[model samples]
Target chain A: MVMRGLVCLLICLNVVGVCHDVSAGMYDEEEGAFETVSALNSDHRFWDDVRLTLSHVYAYGTSESGAIANRSSLRYEFDTTFFKRFSLRLDGRSSLYWKQDHQAGVDDTNALAQNDLRECYIQAGFDAVSFKAGKQVVVWGETDGDVINDVISPRDEREFVFTNLEDARLGQPMVSMDLYSPWGDVFVFVTLDPKVNETPAPGTRYFRGPAGIRVENEKPDTSDQESGIKWKKIFHQFDLSVMAARLRQNTGVLVYDHSDTYKKKYPSYWFYGMGARYATGSLLFTLDASLKRHYQLQTVDISGRYAGSECLMTDNALGVEYDAGGRYTLNAELTHRHIVNDQDDLAGVKQDTDGLFIQYRRLFLNDTLTCQYRFYHQFQEGHTIHNGELDYLFSDHIRVIMDYTFFRERNQRSYYWTYRNDDRISCEIRYYF
Target chain B: MKKTALICLIMVAFASAAAAGQAREIMEKVDNRNDGQTVIAHVSLTTFRYMTQNGKTRAMEQARIKRMTFVKKDEGPREKDHKSVSILREPKSEQGIGFLQYDYEEVGKETDQWMYLSALGKVKRIVAGNDNEPKTGSYFGSEFNYEDMEAYNLDDFTYTLLGPETYRDTDCWVIEAVPVLRKAKKSNYSRQILWIDKDRDMILKAVLFNRNGKKTKIIMSGNIETLDGILVPRKIVVDNVESRRRTVLLYETIVLNRPVDDEFLRVRTLTDKGYRERKLQEFKDLK
Candidate 1:
């Protein structure tokens, strides 16, 4: 009778679970594996045991284009176990942005705030089968540079190392289904809004683009699907994964014009791509190439803005990473995008652009300290630019970062324009419990 | 002053209640367990790593031991009085002979530890303590402390009977124990809740909590054996919750009141390597 009562009491507490991570190390006296699987956090004493964390960061930078920007963000996270085979967590972030208006030309220093419900998920286990669903981060690929399934949400890209989501394309408030077996794992996601709006052509306008650059309209009814599969073992250590996705727009028409007010109606924003990744211990390799076909407005008879062009574009990316014990890690990657059409050169400029990135980091002071250097170069024949960044982790929780970006252009007269540069200096502190 | 006095009184009342419950439970169980002979057993130790420095790490294997001894209490001095010795070998065998000697002391808590290095040709004293903190700190880096293997002392901690429960198959009284010293923080458990068998006063299972109030380790006792009417646990298993690690102790033999000589337990006997060799040789020669 006593044991039965105790078990019932534990079950009741599990239903109305309360979890508060004590301020102690993971090796607590009551050390049992913590697991979670329910939407309601219950059975805390039996399964809930983990740390909670909060962080904040602020940064300022001036670009060669004379654009000065400042940004800050605050983030909070809660993770805990519920029941013996379930776990759940929530992460939230809010950011503020401000800019200086006068440096080179356009001046707008309005501060803006943006926040998204990042991830809220629960995991469950039944015999050998387990499932996790809700808003969650789907991380795939073996390279930091070319991620495939990382498409949960867009991140701030202006900073050197923005704590943003990688595959911003796929994680669009979607419901995901996962299946696991001894041989491999597979998962699929369904999104409400599938198509991602593309950048407006220069000298053209959009109705719904951010900053009123485009006419804002309700997202078209299009089914967005993304999924991936992974094989458990390849030569005992190697892991392999493949992923793909597609989205079609069924919304209102988009129009582009040539008189700096040109408009075009887009029937759909459709893209499909496949990616592959492999990893072995400290070494990782990734390759992702996708073809994109989009509608573009062209000047008809050199006068009207209604002439249209359907351009076929291809993007290729390759990334490699090597971790040399605890001493250093080196990563190198390149991305090339090409528009396959006679009009690839639009208005006397090549539309094809290529980008390169290389980064090296060293962990000294027994991993208590670290230093990193990164280089980025983007090119489109006449317009070539390079950016450099250096960061040092002064301690386990503190970091100092520096970035310099250089821009250069060549005129028809073969004269090189004055070099334009941007730089930023910042420091941040982080702690976990 | 009135509030302080009230708070002090409340604390005193709670402590007294806790003590009364513990004493009542202990008395009920140990009333029939007086003046019983205790027996030591020879056993091999094995442990499986469920946790490592890195997460989800594990390793497993067997250990090596050179010798083991049995000790007991009696009314009068016999041939085997006060003589106890055990040579523990290194877990991973190396090129030559490498072992440690556990020299038992009579009527005291201290146990002398001397390690023999084949290259040195001498026995080196590695540890000397009253079988308390030092012995309990480490034993071949396994989870079991020396105190955990010895007799339980009431003075080591304050115990309170929370209630009763069934542990494995035994009906037991649930007791909560709080260590007395500040340094006890480094022990496997910050606090312990044990389910002691109501009939034999043997702990059937103990749930250890971390300083953070989380359950971290579980120790279960099994395979009871009786020697001169004293019940003893012949096997024990310790499980680390977070690391998924486990260590099991199984004894192969148990003996009590065996024939042993006093001279064999002397300090000189421990130091004389030739004497040890000659004694073993004489035993072999007798057979």
Candidate 2:
């Protein structure tokens, strides 16, 4: 039950304007700024390189005419090294709220706050090899926003695709090793504990489960261990990487027992993926493909009985990015997915799907303000989503981001049909210290 | 009579070629100066938009400050071939952000770059960025573009001696450089005029012109100090003519010839936070 996905955009310019004044007060004139820093740089202090951030987000629902969310978050991050080879990182965050409004039927306790240990790792390097162990997030993909090969960590899908992938990712415990070589770099990882995605829980928007159906989880224990390996090489004008992993499914496959309950299970599967990127002039091309064996898929019959299907899943994407020199940038991606062994009598979901995603961005006012428009269309389901956002950097330590999203669906059987009315606006402010 | 005329033509050609060679020799000497093999420094950049009043430039009240730690090491004897990494220390929003670059001098060899985005918690390989836009083609929103920060490739331009003049009470040689065709396509400046302190073999001032032959930026380097028997500029300022913005770069604490591990320049520097910090702390401890 989280509203982080529907990052509604609101124009709280007045509030940011006030914060700007306060920030200015804390900032001094340029004449003596560096002069003061010169003395400080000579000394080491406890908070010298430590970082803390304060953020607030407010969202309003247009379709439901209600307050979707009002929350504040504090984040602490610090990293240090000692003994030449040993290093540690401690990063954590806490989400809370004050003077908040709760939407009807929304579990305020669960929906408002979503906090985590974003990343905390200690690594030791020895010449050509390094080992890191802790809670960490690893990204291994060429496509943006879409997951093809970047599936090492579970994602928070409570808000569906509305939230940015960066914000949705959840770091898990793992021990990774890297071997740097002249030919290429090799990476290996073993998950200490496997976890599943955070889906929409009860009393939250986009929850399509049967009314008041009891939910249960069948989690993986120590015996269901998973591991992965990757090889990356950089060429003259391009880079390529290939990886394979035996990982548990991130999505929970629901199983109904004919009783008033549904058991969610994450089955283990084999995943193989490859990614490559090429850059020439101002244009860059990226490609990623992944194949999953024995992927679990679920379907519900008209009688409300759920059945599980094990099929081979293949996902491919090609993306292109062009920057007309910092003033404007354009990115477009094409995706194709197939359930090779899908059942012909399957209901609701399709066996194959194709999608097109494009985003355009521009900068203004000495690059302090940015405007972006992102759109994605599902060709098979005829589902579409448009998101527009403005990010303003008031200062080095303060940023305000406002965004609005609109979702449209033509096929009721499509998953997007459930969020067709989730269009809304939101405003967020972040201050770093 | 025809033989005499031929002799004069040959003499003129030899003189002209020698003059051109002399200019290149001077630039080569400047490039070959022993600044340092390894450098570690704390850098501060203060920037602000300014307005011209009564033939004088006055800085506006609003100024932005950015602090970072710059580490660079020369790869070998080749020119413009080195590895550099900069880690942001201030602007808490961007703290711990690191940029790593490997500049190569081989023809047709592109520079390799990577960035560690703390917010995303990943290391991302970057492309040759900001080739066209002058407004956003800057280093950390400063007046110094990547080109300005880069070491000049002697082969990229043709140099002409513009005679000597006394600047700031020091004897300096004025030189004009026009970019070659291949470099012009990727360069924002069409020509550059540099004031070099011939004796010290250092750059004192530079005025750069845009592709349209309009003077776009004025750069001045001063506060030279000798550290570890190498001349270093402690303060440098850049003034943008078109945008009326200026940025001042000051080295708060700098040390030269610091023994840096070879592995520190690898991609791991951008990805491994603790290792980077640990390796840097030893150097940072030195005043």
Clashes of 2: 5
Cα displacement (Å) at residue A406, model 2:
1.3
The backbone clash count of each candidate, in order, is: 48, 5
Number of the top lDDT candidate = 2
Q: What is the model-wide C-alpha lDDT for candidate 1?
A: 0.45
The collision pairs in model 2 are A8-A425, A8-A426, A9-A425, A9-A426, A10-A426
Candidate 2 displacement at residue A420 in angstroms: 1.3
Tell me how large the interface RMSD of candidate 1 is: 24.7
Q: Once model 2 is optimally superposed onto the true structure by TM-score, how far is the C-alpha of residue B230 displaced, in angstroms?
A: 1.6
Per-residue lDDT of candidate 1, residues A1-433 (tens digit): 3224433543444344323221112221222211121122211132112222223333344543333434444554455444545656565666554443111112233655667555666765443344666765544343345322333333332232332222132223556555544555555666554433233222221112223334433344443343333332222223345555443332223344333443434343345455554544445566666665663423233443334455676767788766553246677888777778776334332456677768787754323244666665554445444445454433222234455544555543211232233343333333222
Where is the poorest 10-residue window by lDDT in model 2 chain A?
A: A20-29
Residue range B140-194, candidate 2, lDDT tens digits: 7788877788767889988888789887677998888888887787788999999
* Candidate 1 DockQ vs. native: 0.01
